[model samples]
Target: MTKSVDSTAPVLTSVRQRTGVIELNRPKALNSLNPEMIDIIAKAVKNWEDDDSIDQIVLYTTNPKAFCAGGDVRFARDNILSGDAQLVDDFFAAEYTLNGKLATYKKPLVSIIDGVVMGGGLGISLHGSHRVVTENAFASMPEMAIGYFTDVGVAHAAQRMVGTRGQASPALAKYWAITGYRMYAADMLWSGLATHAVQDAETILDAIVENGADTALKQHSYVPDGEAPLA
Candidate 1:
């Protein structure tokens, strides 16, 4: 059975048996992370963490263009432009805390990286135990483009991806660390950022349910054996 909750009037939470699905419903905002939404997500995760019933969690978005674009830049711009340093500090602190929680989460967590999985979106998805990317998926760090360094543990995650002080030319690392160039699904998988590349989002979701919550995830669970008609 699937259950849902509408918190902060915009974000929607859905749970099916031991699987919880959190949907970023603000398609107009490109499902950008905002203060309220962040709080809601953190609280929901905490609740599920203690609930023995939930063994898996899936974070996704309603917008096909973006799983999540990133933090609400307009919000940041307004606060910074208005000379509100406290707002900036608070936002970063809260967002980073939420990211950390997800990183070390106990239960199996699956992130569906279907669209614009950039900056903030990367934080939400990259740390999950199972990260699924679809053909529509694109990922990047691109914080330098906006005159900011990567945050939300990008430094650590990047090093993990590139290895510690390897001579293999840090160009790939630099692209994500500095330029924030969005990577396609294939590149994301090759770079070891996304675990699996699925052909269709719905099929992957169905597979998760059918596989049972306690089943160990297969690395290539997303890849279909052969091509099929488009849904």
Candidate 2:
């Protein structure tokens, strides 16, 4: 049984057996990665890494509409325009560091990405051991649209995708980075961006509970058949 933590918390963290669960809690903001959220998550991840009770992590969002829309770009823009550019710098430092930590995490890291996983969202989930996408998921690196270069380790991730899926040329990867084109679940799978695509969130979690993370993912993954339906 899952234990409920403080519901009011901006980012809720809990543990079940060897699995540590992190749920992004700011649905109204589309669970945007802000400075505070970044700090809290980074701290929690470090603590969990050291905790004997936790052996793995599952990062997900509470909102069904969005795992994370992006970074707190509005906040970043406002602060920069107000001449408080330090805030932007701090945000980047914290976010990129957290992204690195997630990428290199010693234990298994599972990201349950359902919807609107874009920009900084991809940074958080894409680097982990498992990236589980749902039918509703929509992904992109939309930083260019906001006049910002793709960041938060996106450059490296995009490069890896290009190498893994040789069908897509290097120039195509660059175009996606610079153009902010949205990608559906099939496209993401085809491009080697996500690990698995499932029909729903509950099904994946139930599989995880029964079969453990990696086995469950392999069993449910739609990639083997090479058929990721658009509908």
Candidate 3:
């Protein structure tokens, strides 16, 4: 059975063939997550988390230019200027909670990332079980650029990467956190930030649904579709 979540929300959600799909929708704003968007996503994630009918979760962005530019810093900034400390705090509280939920989710979570994925974007995608990227994917934490520390569970991932870098430098994640270096597809894959590099996202989603994640990934990983990923 297919059920559509509220179409009017900033984040769009639906269940299709036992998969819960989330599409980030604020295209004009580059799909940056705001408090309301966070709430909507959290609700859908929670609602589907324990549902036996939903076997997997898929997250992507409708914006072609950006997967997610991260959390809406402009929203926080305006609230800060207005002296709404509580609003700002509430936003982070909810965002982090959603991040944690995905991190610990029992079911498989797959994120097909293309275009700009930064800060909170990485938070949502990287923690998932399958982090799929295309040739167009460009990722960064970039919090240091604005005088803020990079967060949203990135530190947890960085800590795990310390001693286990197979093709990447042991210090790669740490260096990125400090320098906010922008990484393209090859670097993202080698650094272990992205688990798979594919020709397209949509086909991979369909394949996963039909063939299961491990088999579909094995059949499609690192294949060329006119333009192969750098890695």
The local distance difference test score of each candidate is 0.75, 0.81, 0.82
Give the C-alpha miss distance for residue 198 in model 1, angstroms: 0.4
For residues 1-231, could you state the per-residue lDDT of candidate 2 as single tens digits?
A: 354467887788777667888888999999998887888789878988988877678888888999988899889989999999987998988898899999899888888998898888988898888888888998988878767787878777766663224554555568777888887777777776777888888778767766789888878876535554421
C-alpha lDDT of residue 56 in model 2: 78
Which portions of model 2 show Cα errors greater than 4 Å?
1-5, 162-169, 224-231
Q: Local error of candidate 2 at 208, Å?
A: 1.6
Candidate 1 lands at a TM-score of 0.86
**Backbone collision count in every prediction?**
1, 0, 0
lDDT of 1 by residue, 1-231 (tens): 655544444567878766888888888888889898898889889999989888788887777788988888899999989999799789989999999999999988888777787778888888888788888888788789889888878667765663212223345666677666667765666566777777767667666766753253462354434332211
Tens digit per residue, CA lDDT, model 3, 5-90: 55656888877787888889888888898988898788888998899998888897877688899999999999999999899999
Better-scoring candidate (lDDT), 1 or 3: 3
Relative to the true structure, candidate 1 has a C-alpha RMSD (angstroms) of 5.0
Question: Which residue pairs collide, candidate 1?
Answer: 142-180
